[model samples]
Target: MTSSLFEPEPGKDKEASSASMPPALKLSLEMGPLVIFFVANFFGQWLIDHVPLFSSFEKPIFPATALFMIAIISSLATSWILARRVLVMPLVSGVFVLIFGSLTLWLQDATFVKIKPTITSVLFALILFGGLLFKKSLLGYVFDSAFQLDAEGWRKLTFRWAFFFLFLALVNEIIWRNFSDDFWTNFHVLASTIFTFIFLATQMPMIMRHSLEQPPSDKNEDHAD
Candidate 1:
């Protein structure tokens, strides 16, 4: 029995080690970096005024981009520490954050950070569609075994998500390119969250129809008998 720094202890159950963290903690780990980015952007001027180091930046978004990069790295590290593994989607997004966020800071341009979401969304859409070419529902792999569904269900769901990602990419491009920075920031924090929730809610019927897990109600009825 050998183990590395990240590996579960010899006596620990592998499933337990990889099991999802508590919902509240998981949500915090995932959303905390975004909240930090929003806050940093909103308070950039204040930071620049007080923090002598930030005096070089003319706009808030650049500082925001730097903080975003740091926050995202911290978030991913925390997630890995807690869950023993980082989820695929956040890891992918974090990689882009580092890349584009660094480009934003290094070049002293906001466009890189602003277009990060659009690029990431498009990449995800491409990955999903590419998987479908080989008859694979890559979304399942991306989601880290969250649930199971029939093959047809996976194909349908994958198609829905691929198109949804493309739609999100389009929306991101429109907002960031056509709107004020503050407006785009607000849309990123608020509207994107709402849109994702709405999209997931819309998919509940399909998820229920194809869910491999038995319903609680069915288990209750069986117990009664």
Candidate 2:
């Protein structure tokens, strides 16, 4: 096919500049904040106790909350440095983390931090499903760099992902609400990862089948060079 869809971008050496990294690395980078949040929670109390101003937050969960905000800030700063663009979704998430995390510390209650996953999950599901109602491939926008798909394919894949997100939100809510904090944390980490991997595997066939076989039109190719 004589198409420019696969052609290198002009004026930019994508292969050298930033394209050398694989999709999984890019995704992990985007998930930096969540990862940091988890790590901070595990060691935040001790870290906070060391900081003079935060020494008042020396209480277990209180210190954790302070450290969580610090991690969120660190994540956002790194994202801005690497991407050089404002990531809307993660920015929203960081804002929530700062706000609710601070509240958790102020109130000395763990409920605020516990609610984060539920809120983020429900918000994600609602946004995804709402896009489906409008016949838009919302997932395409989020995952555009990871994979390519035709219109119909993107729509179908998006709808399925949207429903899956809703299901995940329900699962998070139930576990956090009814279980001990330690058990809920374990489920959030290990169980959620397993669930996501399985779901992605199940969608592979559909993704391959629906992807566009032909490249995009050369006429639409950018002439940035």
Candidate 3:
């Protein structure tokens, strides 16, 4: 069966699958790969020295990218086994990880992996804006079950998210170019998560303001009275 990335599965609401997944487990699964990436980057040589399999990687980043690719695959597989389906957000990220991680390994250059986040962010922004051009609020496919909102609300939220994605892309470009690889690695995992949480929190007020949960019957009753 065909499925849209942002669309919920048949016979299930958008929130159903998400609700069934425990918050802590979901958080761990999502963060696990980045943690692996960070640790591998830092301690790769020790692993290379001790683990014969990793010895061929001349630099830490190479093995780190390889380990990261493995970690992302493992994470995606585990997520599918546990949740019965992969989350679109992480699935998209995993795809980029595999693609750029492979390039990093095959080309023996770190630039591909380093720019993965920036490219992913830009791609997401493009998807969001493209949805708008079609007169569709595709973000609603991802979030409608959680936040009941009118069309206008979805449009506003989608526009905000698209811009936020662009901002993320810019931040990633600036950091990776200006900072040390280690520092950029740290920022990749930590700063992005913090910024995303802050952005989501900031959107709550607007979401509440446009909520569509009140029953139409209630409105009709009030009008009759």
RMSD of each: 5.7, 8.3, 4.9
lDDT of 3 by residue, 21-135 (tens): 5657667777899999989989978888988888877778888888899988898788677766676677888899999999998888888999999999999899989989998
Tens-place lDDT per residue, model 1, 1-225, is 433333332224445544645546656777888899899999999887888878888898878878888888888788677776665677788999999988888888888888999999999999989989998787765432444565666777888999999999999999999998888988998899899889988987776666657564533343211
- The TM-score of predicted model 3 comes to 0.82
Candidates 1 and 3, the one with greater TM-score: 1
1 against 3, candidate with superior lDDT = 3
Clashes of each: 0, 0, 0
TM-score of each: 0.83, 0.75, 0.82
**Model 2 lDDT on a 0 to 1 scale:** 0.64
- Number of the top-ranking candidate, with TM-score as the measure: 1
Q: Which prediction has the highest lDDT against the true structure?
A: 3
Query: Could you tell me the TM-score of candidate 1?
Result: 0.83
* Superposition error at 198 for model 3 (Å): 1.7
Q: lDDT of all the models against the reference?
A: 0.77, 0.64, 0.79
